[model samples]
Target: MNTFIKSARVLSDGQLPKSGTIYPVLFMISISHLLNDMMQSLIPAVYPLLKEKFGFTFAQIGIITLVFQMTSSILQPFIGRLADRRPKPYSLAIGMCFTLVGLLTLSVASGFVPILVAVGLIGWGSSVFHPESSRVAQCASGGRKGLAQSIFQVGGNAGSAVGPLLAALIIIPFGQSAIGWFALVAVLAVLILVKIGNWYKRQLILATGKSAVSSEAVHGLTRRKIHTALFILAVLVFSKYFYLACMSNYFTFFLIDKFGISVQSSQYCLFAFLAASAVGTVVGGPLGDRFGRKYVIWGSILGAAPFTLMLPYTNLVCTILLAIIIGLIISSAFSAILVYATDLMPGKVGMIAGVFFGLMFGLGGIGSAFFGWLADRTSIEFIFQISTLLPLLGIITGLLPNIESKREVLNK
Candidate 1:
């Protein structure tokens, strides 16, 4: 018992008398990120099922997604700033509570309106969770920011992978209603665990008579660099997230409508895409660290364009293979983008995370709406083709001035 308590304390506080503690914190942060991601992925995973059950059209479904994304994105910057000012664990705990409520509501709701309301709640919950949790991860890393961010991002991808498979399993036997109940129960369990961890962290601070360090205090990047980087990041994030949202919200529809695949088969492809993305997340960070972050970022942007363009033309076997390959190529840039954002605002990890994850994704929802509109007018193939050019724009933006020069201006 004593050993367990000691280990817990060490893990919670980001203290390692030796080198072994990093992995555990990395693992926990990853799991927490995954839980948050699972919530996001689960919604899309079951979109087809919902469409069947509720008789929603593609346009209406797009609106529903838009509402969720916009709400979440708009609120992120505020949540992120708050995370910077406050104790991160407390913020994260609050986020978890929102997630729990949203999931629980989703489980019991019976109509489209009710489901929309629940999804809105879930978006708010996600907005809360990401910024704060990211701050905690940065703190916990004790300075290996790149690796920490990568592992943390990978957790969300991992959850995305698992959510569909789990949904498929639950939906098959128990029905969609059962899946919601299962999600609620699972979220509750996670909430309890996070709360306990927060309580333990507070006790340790009391015991030691020292508070955890603020994100801003640990590292410093100049204001100018932050502004410049954010501008560039905003462009990239907007484009990247726009593409991701369209894929998540509509890919199943595309598979069904275009390829004539069963709903189950479409989901399987989505799972493959997410699973491959998980690998990209894992690979992207270290590659960034070893090579220059810029190269990985630009390379991914350029490399993924062809694949994105190719997605519309492929057969089932080819589409599955291409989706996985596209996942790897596109996702490889994700962690690097986060790292670059953080590097731009070195001390403001929470704020950067919020803006990038929350705002970008939210705005992407809006972009997704535009894409959906395009789809309505034309076709999914055109949407995919148009989106392929977006990353090239990102590659251009990434070529902006270095962090050092930007910092010099801020120092003035």
Candidate 2:
């Protein structure tokens, strides 16, 4: 852990990193991520109840997703850039406050418009949360960035997996008002983030007072090459998240329509898929570090193609199994991709995280809205059939320049 910090000899803006991976800070932030995303995931987990309570059409459902995702997507880059210019250690706690209010509002929301407003506020909180937290993860990486990112990402994935199950137990039966109970989660995240903020502030103080000792690692790629790589990464994100959006938002409807399962059962299946994804997230980073991120990115995205294509035609048990397989295979790409991009563009971890995460949310919104419109015209199964083809876009992974070799040379 201390190796990377010493070798990179720089964090960002001339800030020197501490000598080793800060396990306490990393685990603390992971806990905060779990609490944060667990609350956010509740929004989608409660969609069935919302649809029944409000008699919402598929299009309206899509619009709700759009509102939430767009709000989450749009502000991240700006916030990240601002943090890059001026690191705001305490902003994390402040952001969670929005989530708390949003939860209370969602609990009492009686109309569709109110629900939209509530989700929008929660999205605002997420926009602030992701990029800053990603920055924190990298800061504490001690140079094992892929491992650090995986640890950080797995928390959110685990929280995502748990959210639907919690909703099944708590909200599905108790009704929407039970959502207010999760405000306690937001409050807990805030307290944890405040402690993280103090640690971050102290790190900044220590680093800022030091004299310049070293510079960032150079990847030796030209500007044009770097830009082209970034564009490919964006396309890969689009492919990954767009397919994920369909599954996360509509897979429940598909299961209910096709198999006549109860909403609670469908939520359980969703939890299984998300749980597999969390497990997959754990391996992606260290694997990338051990092998090469390029191969991991390529295989992670493209590897799921067969299972996804086979999913729509399967029996209930088979479908559930296929979804879990697909989740595990495809979910590994983002960590490798993010860490790789940061490697390509050294010293811009926050901005890179913001762009990719924002693209993730934005593309997810567009994809959900598109699939909802398509499902209304055709059928849920039909949309899944079409959406399954999206992973084919992973073939474009071939276009990403191989920078891992360069990184190896630098390490040597």
Candidate 3:
């Protein structure tokens, strides 16, 4: 009896601490991640309203998205380099400031030109956060890359889910003007958090007795690997953006035009898709750690392909379920991809994330324009069909020799 009790106590003790100690670093990463996601998700909720108010043609909307993406993409490599050299928290705070300013500007803007400018600023601000925050999170995770990244990414998904819903709640009754007030409040909140994060980082440095100028921990990859990885990553980015842009640029039209759904209902579907993505992000990281990152990523790609194909043919219930599934697969795949890219770059997590997140999302804007053109020439159905194949390509690429294996080959 005593032996049995002792064994049970041991098992309980092990499980208890596992459930008890929420890692503070993970919490911090999650908060920053949420902020980033919120910024990205907020735009779509207001985009349809903007189009009506501004009299934007499809092409014009494409251009606005393009400008925002291109500017942010252009800035990512530089921002990433800075994050590697400077304090990451400082970089994150700077990015937040840009977001705050952009939101404030957006709230007040009346003209198309000013709105474009505000979007660009917001994009640029968002561009900086991922690389720096990701690097810090990766460092803090002590090799639990998948779990840590997922936790960090879940925050973004949460933000994304909330941003659109919150925007809808505000804009539905109060009109677009309410968005400005919300932005003002959000900006103030972010500013306070940024200050707290900065101070906390300083405290960590002091506690560790480490100088601020520690040498870069990740280095020594060959140029060939770097180029190859970047090439593959760029393709993934393009494919990702292609699908994202199509959905973001046209999902509303697809719903209203094809299905006879109300505008509000379509918006709600978009929110549903994002909310599911957040859930997926939470699941993806841990799954990636337990399974191989490569396996989890490839599986997501394969899973997403079918959903994409089904989306155009489905009714409302099926479409929403598919959207949620797609969100899960894409968010999970991307989170794993982000962690994989950071692993490839090692000490250069910030730079890799900048390229992957910022450049990819930005480039997606360009892809969105192309999709818009495609929609103009052909039907939206064709656009959806073509976009569906992208994930298949990703699945194929992921099957190629692993990055680690490639590194070994290069070293030989």
Candidate achieving the largest TM-score: 2
Evaluated at residue 59, the lDDT of candidate 1 is: 73
Residue-wise lDDT of candidate 1 within 1-412, one digit each (tens)?
3433333333333332333325566677688778777776777777777778888776766777787787677788788766555444455666667767777787777888888888788888778877766766655565566687789889989888877877777764466666556555446536644754574355334424333333341225457755766676677767677777777777777788878988777777788888998988887878777765767777776778777777777787887788788788888777788877776555566677888887666766787678777888898777776776666665675555555344446668
Residue pairs in steric clash, candidate 2? none
Clash counts for the predictions, in order? 0, 0, 3
Better of 1 and 2 by TM-score: 2
lDDT of 3: 0.68
Model 1 scores worst on lDDT over the 10 consecutive residues at 12-21
lDDT, candidate 2, 56-148, per-residue tens: 988888999999899998999998776666778899999999999999999999999999999999999999999889988988888888999
TM-score of 3: 0.84
- For residue 341, model 1's alpha carbon misses the true position, in angstroms, by 1.8
Q: Please list all clashing residue pairs in model 3, or write none if there are none.
A: 33-156, 34-155, 218-347
Q: What TM-score number comes out for model 2?
A: 0.96
Q: Give the candidate number with the greatest lDDT.
A: 2
